[model samples]
Target: MKRCFLWTLTLLVSVVLVVPTQAQEEKFIKRKVAIGRFTNETQYAKGLFYDKENDPMQKQAMDILSSKLAASGKFILLERDDLDVLMAEAGENMQKIGADYIILGSITEFGRKTEGQQKVFSSTKTQTVEAGVSIRLVEASTGLIIYSDEAKGFAETTTKQSLGLGGAAGFDATLSDKAISSALGQLVENIIDKCVDKPWRSYVLSIDDGTYIISGGASQGIAASDSFVVYAKGKTVTNPQTGIKIELPGKKIGTVTVLQTLGDTPETEISLCSYEGEPLDSNKLSNYYISDK
Candidate 1:
């Protein structure tokens, strides 16, 4: 009997490797994202691009970032340039075209430099072009700015000859664009690494005399005695320029732990819990979100 029980236990544990559950199937869902008007904060005028024939420098950077994001396959891309027009054409409401997150950016640097050495016997000329950008992600549901960063990129070319012409190195056609692309590439990588997935969360289903019932199970990755931070959301702010909304995450209301599980999982979530910090003051438990610590 002992041997039979041990064999059955081993088989059950091994089934975990072969049988896929809802938790494994939907641990992370790909999200939709939108890129709004990228701000131009550079000292150079938006109209003063190296190639005046091309669109504004800020527009070019926006297009580059949009293209990269579309190719990533991690997010469903939404068009910001003609959002209202598309909505009117499709006869859809804002809810149908809404994005989970919105991205905003600014061109912080776009300029060129020329420096050289003059000598009786030898002379050299060098030109350097640089571009920098600042980007931030806003949570659409809450209107909160989640992340922000600034990055710079550079491109340089040099010419050297004996008794070189004493002429300044003017702007090259592609130098500025290349530098902007470089900075944008890094920013895209960081966005992919950090913001691709939303954090896992569960809620409080009910509260007893002193115990609590959590709405998570083993299928959702909950384990016995696991610690979690309980948080309630705060006020939201809107961006006047792009109309993107952001919300503050607010402070931790308290902490809780999984004391035991009560039912079958994935469909019927049931986690019993005990307060690890001060207990709930009111019906705030209804609005609380719990995340693993």
Candidate 2:
């Protein structure tokens, strides 16, 4: 009886020493994103004499892409345009935008060509417009270019049996818009696919005793009992070709549990627990990150 009791106590101690693995969480994880100002590279300034200030082609494309990304339920759209104001007014403490990635876009091609003009006998005129954009999704913490893709779309409109009414037609003016929208659609899809394949990450905005504030809630498909692996983010490495910095993979420090999901605002404060190997250091919360387990 004494030997059996000792063996049972040993098994119990071993079980207590082992940390339980967290079950797999959400089926789909959402990442936070910020859209940056995009540049227009088309050759309209030197020759075409089109007004670019009021309705810039690059701004138009940016708006389209932003709208599409916002409509897609895959991302948490954060505002990057007001970064300067936020820093100046709220200071660095308010600098945490809860964004995981940032998007930079450029309009590489934006032009319209009108060919086969109406002649004495030939009353058919064809107008073709093409718009192309290159997009880069950068990991905000490391500035790594996680995904890069370029898509071009073309729109053609032909006016037949016209009596020199091409000038009054709307095809020339609207073709560019149509083409831009089409290209942006493809870019949005590319972003979604890449993001889906990647494991999502969240940040520890602040810590309150045993509770840690994070940036995911019901909107991101997170809920109570969800588990995460805590890590410390490392220095960002630069991509030599593109000169974009990418965050290096972090070292696992500890684990956290979702004690409760914050109200309807897509924010939550979770509870921290000792990691499997080394106990998590509270002081090294700087550059700390969280990934779903």
lDDT of every model, 2 decimals: 0.70, 0.70
| Model 1 root-mean-square deviation | 12.5
Worst lDDT window (10 residues) for model 1? 88-97
lDDT of 2 by residue, 1-293 (tens): 99999999999988776645333422677777777657787776445566654446777787788788878878877756664454355432432544666677888887888876556754766799888889988665544577999999999987666554444434567777889999889888888887777777776666676567766777777776677888877777778998755667788877777777664554333333323434445566567878875
lDDT tens per residue, model 1, 91-205: 4223233565678888888888888887887777788889998998866544457789989989888766675544545567777778888899888987876666555455677
Model 2 alpha-carbon miss at residue 264, Å: 6.7
| Clashes per model (N, Cα, C within 3 A) | 7, 3
Error of 2 at 91 (Å): 15
lDDT of 1 at 105: 87
